[model samples]
Each structure stands twice: as structure tokens, then as C-alpha cells.
Target: MLTPVTDIDGAPFWEYAAQGELRVQACADCGELRFPPRPCCPHCQSFASEWRRMSGQGRVWSYSVPHPPLLPEYAARAPYNVVVVELADAPRIRLVGNLVRAAGDPLDSLDPRGVRIGQRVRVVFDPATGLPQWVLERA
Candidate 1:
């Protein structure tokens, strides 16, 4: 399980994630959606915001494998996969997360080399964090 750094703008997103729901900030004014929670909508610059639940479905917009483990905490889980997922519900927004338990093994294990672009993925949750993480959307 990965611990998130919570900020004023991002806390709500994590809270929702902990509840096994994927939520993004939607522009209360123009209806534009965004991730990485911000004070205002990037499209309309609206300060108003609300939570919109996602279908927990998306595609791998981009991905990479980190070599030699970037942090000591991850050394044990080396060669893990990190992905920038573009949600099917809102293409403009992408969520960055590790693709853990998508196939097998611990979620923290790093194996970025096995990932592919445009691959279908789905959300999975770790009970330890009570958050909606990600996994391969199996056929």
C-alpha cells in the first residue's frame, strides 16, 4: 500500500479514494473535469467544485518502469509499473498511480517494463488504505 501526501486541494480526492471511489473535481461553473485537485477549474477558472465519481475504468495513457529503485522504500519492489491513466469517463484528465495487483504480486512491487500503452485498466482497492487503487481491467 502506498501512502499519499495529502494537501488541501488533494485531500478530498484521497478521502474518496479511501472509500473505494474514484472522484474528480468537476467545474461547478462550466462542467469541465479535472484531476490532481486544484483550487479552481483549469478550463473555466471557476472556484466552485464538486466531486464526480468515475466508472473506475480507463486506459494506459502512458507508463514506465523505474530502474534501480528510486527510493529505499521501493527497493524490495523494484521494476514496478507506474502508469498515467486516462479515465474513459473523462479523457482530458489523467491519474498517476502504480499498477499494482493488476496481474499478480504485491501492489507495491515495481515492474514497469510489462506495461503497455493504450492498455485497458480498471480500479482496485487496498483494504489497508481503503482507497481505490488500480489493476489491469481483465477481459
Candidate 2:
């Protein structure tokens, strides 16, 4: 039962997700896209930023399956996947999220065994959390 902690820089991300849109922060100065939103751009140190909608397409860059000793809330969902996805629009911008069966599905809905690095996935907003998740793209 993880919840997003909204901050000055990341609030807009949650706001957009609530509207079913996937957006990332881009530096207004250098036009560099970044994730895990922050007040200043790492590349240009710019305080000015804008939210840019993404194509909702990316590939799994890396993943992990948590084992035991997990928090009680997450222990029941053991073997769940946590993936880092590299956005197709901005390869350098990566977002961490779970792989779900569909929009609004639970984080552990998909079997961990099915997740693979480099697998293409699309973004989906979870209505319950007003946050983004991922779903494998079909051929």
C-alpha cells in the first residue's frame, strides 16, 4: 500500500495522472526531460520546468522481484515486480512502477515470472492511487 508523496515539483505529476495522462517534467532552459521530478534540472540547474505529456510507451530497463522480510502490507504481494522503464520519447528519463494487468489493476496483478528486461510496456494510470503503472504491450 505505497502512496505517492506529492511535493512542489511532483504535484503536477499526480495531478496529470488523476486526469489519465502521463507527463514528465522537462527543463525549460535546456529542454531536458527528467523523472522523479525535482525543483531544479540536473543537467541545466534550471528552476523553470514544464510538464510534457508522453507517448506512454517505453521498455523495461531493469526489474526486481522482492523476496521475504517485506512490509506486512506488501508481503502478501510477494514476488511482485518493480520495474524501471526507459521512456521511448526520452530514453534518459526513466520511471519506476509496477506491471499491472490493466489500468486500475493492482500492482501485483501480473505474475513476476512474465516480466522481462527490454520488454515493451505502456503506461496506465491507477485510479485508486492517481499514479502511473505499466502494462506489457501486445504485438
Q: Which ten residues in a row are the worst by lDDT in model 2?
A: 1-10
lDDT of 1 at 58: 98
What's the TM for model 1? 0.86
Clashes of 2: 0
Q: What is the clash count of model 1?
A: 7
Off by over 4 Å in 1: 102-105, 108-113, 130-132
85-119 per-residue lDDT for model 2 (tens digits):
99999898899999999988876799999999999
Q: Candidate 2 versus the native: TM-score?
A: 0.94
Q: State the displacement of the C-alpha of residue 12, model 1, in Å, after optimal TM-score superposition.
A: 1.4
Q: Which runs of model 2 end up more than 4 angstroms from their true locations? A: none
Q: How well is each residue in 63-131 modelled by candidate 1, as lDDT tens digits?
A: 877667467777766767778999999998898877876433464553566689998989876666655
Overall lDDT per candidate, in order of appearance: 0.79, 0.90
Best model per TM-score: 2
Please report the candidate that would top lDDT against the real structure: 2
